[model samples]
Target: MASEKMEGPSAPAVRRDPYEVLSVSRDSSDQEIKSAYRKLALKYHPDKNVSNPEASELFKEVAYSYSILSDPDKRRHYDTAGFEALEHGAMDMEIDLSNLGTVNTMFAALFSKLGVPIKTTVSATILEEALNGTVTVRPLPLGASFSGKVDKQSAHFFGVTINEQQAQSGIVIRVSSSAQSKFKLLYFEQEANGGYGLALQEDSEKTGKATSAGMYFLHFQVYRMDSAVNALAMAKDPDAAFFKRLEGLQPCEVSELKSGTHIFAVYGDNFFKPASYTIEAMCAKSYEDTTQKLMEIEAQILTKRNDLRQFETEYRKALTQFQEVTNRYSVEKQAVDELLNQREQIHSSFTTVRTVAGHIGASNGGGGSKAHLDDSRTESQSDDGSSDGKDKSNKKRWFNLNLNRSDKKL
Candidate 1:
């Protein structure tokens, strides 16, 4: 028996402009676009209009438009080339895992089986827990450390309080796992609602030896994207969803922290094994005095930023040079083509005159045939400084030059 192949969903015959679908202008702000999408999404939600296929389609189109417009790079491409730039698999569809109902989940699974690239986000459960104050948070004083074990997929939270003096000097939190345990170190900012908003997450790096456990250092001026907030925002707006999972920390320089309570989390990364790790919080001023490693890492960060600036400068110069060369080539190519066409016209005229002369000589009973042959030979020699035989060879070479060079080597 042969197996049947499944086909993915086909695109609509007419794809409305994404800006029109979202009911926003091309120059609309990100917040305005987000607001428009949210309004339309709520109105045409599949769960709310289960029987209306039209609403369901509108919902999908709304989501699709948001996916392109929300991303900086994709939106730029779409603006420059329109929908033609997004053909093939250039855009990946993003579906929020948190908001999907049972029916939508089933449809998502079906689409996945049919070979659509669907990017799912992290569940909103942890963020909700923090907002609701349901998660346990232990307090760790400056220069103190705590050791604990977190089950797979679970997290341990620690609160670090900083006073005015400590905030001015800066703070550093470090976490190291035991043996083969792996974990992600997370930092949270307090919201006005007295809840925590996730600010940064750093993946643990392998230290000591190849078989050693993962370690994470949350030093000052080294914060990056907050995945938790991004996920929550995407869930709320739906327009901010991304195709790829956000990973890694971005280098930044911060002078100091505010005087208040900040939270840090250690999340177990292992699937089957629990992670045992130690978390420490210390004032940067004191910590740097004890070890030179922190200073060395800071130096490396500065060096990397300088290197990036230099690379950008070189890239711009090279791009300008390439454009100039391409423009020159286009102009020169047009001139060459015009000259070749004129040469072909002249060759055609000469060939016609030679044929007429041969017919005239035959009609005259070959009386002037010898004179005509001599005249033809003299003309060919004068044209190219070559004899009649060599003239024929040169014409053959010229014809070859006009042949397609698709298979020719450089």
Candidate 2:
């Protein structure tokens, strides 16, 4: 498939830089890069920057960059080829950027070069034209043969006559099917009409009646219709001047028969008993024309079968590869999902720890304020000078105990 598509006129187009659009360095880790993308995305989001075409365009660019960078395979591709590599995969599995206007033209061209086939349906009309044709016969000099009607139980005879003037130049003759003929040729004899001389002889070598429809062989001969010698005796004798002793089934030819009036006799058997069979003589060119057409049709059929088999083999191979790729994509997507979840968990935990630390610091500050208030109260009360020292020592002990506990907890 790839080889076939490569025969097209042009290759796929290249793509622009995704990393530059996202404003991230190639070495940026996933978290830092994604954080930067979020800040840029919010600033340029179409909703936030309504009626701003530049911001809207920037938003689209940011989204595209983030999408590819977020995927491991896509990121690897972008890193390796700086965005051009995304065009090389099959079309069905990707977002067809061609459907998007303007800047997407490059993507469409890129996909075409990747050997992605443009599918088309073959119409029935076109298929019919490919599979069918008519045979045409070219003009040739008309010739004579024999004509007769035969049935299941009997042989038939026809006397053929050709112009004596044309006798020297031999002609081709055909005995072919005429309306509803079922006769399967067994033998043919051309002899003078005067004989009742044929005697039945049983030969074990002869097969029984046909069980299927097909061509059966016949021996052809010719005899002058005016000859007096017994026709059957002439046919029985090997030395008899026979037409050619040729063999054929109906709708076919025997080559080179002399031009003269002659008695032609045919003997054949049939499978299904039909009412009657007609044999008509015709020019051999007609037979040859249809024969060549039939051979061509057979060759075409063989070629079509081979093509269908090859298509089936290629389809199966493509399906297998597609399945494998899909499975890999699924696994990679799952891993990315897991990583995102873990990142969220870590972020949430960090936020919780910061909130707790802030609360602890506020509590410590409140405890220190209360200690300063108590010291001021003791200094004010110390004018009596009786338990001032003891009170100061007690206050110091209480403050130290609370501070020690708070420090331990921290």
Candidate 3:
């Protein structure tokens, strides 16, 4: 009943085991865990205990615990890795409309407007009508089909009765809708009191194919739900009931069904438009008789496979080209790197030569002028004195040799 954001614990609250939080064992069945959560949630619900300051927190903890146990994937992860493996954002808000009072519903609606992802159960009105035998239910026999229009926010119910033999062989109920039709497939089981109770609900999936006339279609496959839990008790806590029912749900196998009438309801989910659809009930044997249609579906599969092969061929060609270009780029890059190294060496040699020349010019312009004058006088003297000329020639030869060595080092 609390209208808070219903998020996981943000602060470091006590990290209790989910099983302990729900007061159930780790090996408990899904139904047992669900029942425990419902009991705790109803007890700690904010609407009933307004004076208790801790009731809201207890309600959130109860919801979070159930969220982990309700999902098989999450439950397995928790069992293996504990709460650290479960992400806080993965916890979704689940509201049970049948269990909530008027005030709680008002608050839930207000919070829903604030963008919380609150998953509500089937409308209490609808469930009540179904229980009272007021909702219209049309009979759909095996190998037969019915077409109808269901208005927005409404549903069309059909009852399919199967005997022990048919139940053993199995059944497959398929529903197809016109282009862009949005609806849900709801399955129900008849109770001992001759009233139908909700069992499972599934959204329509696009068929991914179009007719020759270019009309798209949506398809539905009946999924079986566990009908062991009490429907009357579930109506009191629908959210928990919904999650429990969802666990282990698989495509309908009539062998697992009882020999009685089962209900299939097509509920329109479009915002403003009605849905036009055809519902068909077929035994598994009858379904196998549609050999031509099956072949057509197989042909579509083959075409898709061929298209995949073509894509793979093109992918390989593209990959080969990519590798060739990459190799070319690597070769070109190496050539460019070698040229850059040569250019750098040349630039370095030029810089060293310029530095040496600048030093020589500075020395010559300063006190080196007197030194040059002395060298000239000495050379004149050497010309007059042959012995001195020989000495000066030897010194000039040594200086030339040292300059050549320096240039070689550069």
Candidate 4:
């Protein structure tokens, strides 16, 4: 009998390249994988394309790719060994994907470009099947209290997601700064379930308390939306301005520290605090680097302020010159009017002389002393009857016989 073909168990068949399965780079971000799954699902979902059963197969692949890549443990294992290293059935095996809704894939653009072949719903179904977790609904009564210290045990990142059934569209959530700082926080909201989710490892992460006045944490918020979608970016301070962009959805992504009593007013509006709880922390840098960065920023600000002051001085000087020019313009206008009036008077007096000079036939009529009409001007020409008006022409004459005169003033 022919040797039995090397048959395998009903485990997931390993695809050529896990990265190619997800249609992403080897170093793609978690958000990128999630986004890719969503797009692939829409394309290859059986429900989306009834004529294409192949889409479902592609969908299953994308789901599997995202599932294995997203989990840190599984990704590490896959990296070290070939596909066989993971528990055999682990590839196609069913895993819970729902409860991790708390985790958001902020990068929407990267996935659409991954060039995967699948439908979105299929991918979602695959995802929904792969990473499902238990979700607990912790409801608090109106005016209830829930507080405590949440000193994070590690340097990793963590975040909180809140969903209110009543508000099913958009939910704005808050994350406090530190122990003594409360009112300042970073906020996030996603999903039609009215759930809010914040980043655990974001540098802008805050877990402080509210004590006194304006001096507090600053939240760095990035306002963006899928450039193609209407998803709105959270305003930097939520009060700043509305900006939107991104190719997928949730375009804006930045962590800003909250300030003032606003955080308390929103968080404790219905619930109070207790003694201890599951508050999370983020990957903060070593204090030295952070401090040095801040100092650099402060120095840049001072330098910029000095530059502005110099520019202001220059602006003021220009303004003064502008005022002076305006004054000169007014004076010129008055002078022009006076000159016009003087011109009229001179024209009146010289009009007759002008008329009389022409009557002299242009030469003084051979008498060498002709009497022109009207202001009947007298002219002493050369004895030869040539014109003799040279001394009166201002154009060629440079010497002044009388030098001590102070006659011309402008």
The whole-model lDDT of each prediction reads 0.63, 0.43, 0.63, 0.39
Worst ten-residue run, lDDT, model 2?
Answer: 197-206
- Residue 97, candidate 4: how far off, in angstroms? 15
For 127-154, candidate 1 gives per-residue lDDT tens digits of 5566556789999998999888887557
lDDT of 2 by residue, 54-161 (tens): 875565556556656755557897667554465432111222221234555445445433533221111122212222321111222345333445443244544546
What is the per-residue lDDT of model 4 for residues 1-410, given as tens digits with 9 covering 90 to 100?
11221123332243656677768887888767666655565466555556776665666666666657866657888788746565432333221122113232212213323421111211233223222321222333222333444221111112323234312222233233333322212232233344323221111212234221111122322222122121212222232112222212221232333221111111210012211222322222223355356447655654654575576578668879999999999999999999999999877886667777776666656654443341233343444334546645542343442332434531
Reference-based lDDT, residue 143, model 3: 87
Measured over all alpha carbons after superposition, the RMSD of each candidate to the real structure, in angstroms, is: 21.8, 37.2, 14.6, 25.1
Candidate 2 clashes between residue pairs 3 or more apart in a chain or in different chains: 12-113, 222-243
Model 4 accuracy (lDDT, Cα): 0.39
Mark the regions of model 4 whose C-alpha exceeds 4 Å error after superposition: 1-14, 92-410
> At residue 290, what lDDT does model 3 achieve?
59
Cα deviation at 110, candidate 2, in Å, is 64
lDDT, model 3: 0.63
TM-scores across all candidates? Answer: 0.43, 0.22, 0.51, 0.26
lDDT by residue (1-410, candidate 3, tens digit) is: 11223225442245567787888888999757765765576567665667897886777678777768877768999899777677554354544444567788667666544533345544445655675678998999988989888885578999889898887656666677756475667776565577776655655544564101111111223333332222322444564453333333333322255568888888765444687778888776555445346447645654654565576578668879999999999999999999999999888876677788887997878877778888988888878765485787888899999999999999
Off by over 4 Å in 2: 1-148, 161-179, 185-254, 259-263, 266-268, 271-275, 282-410
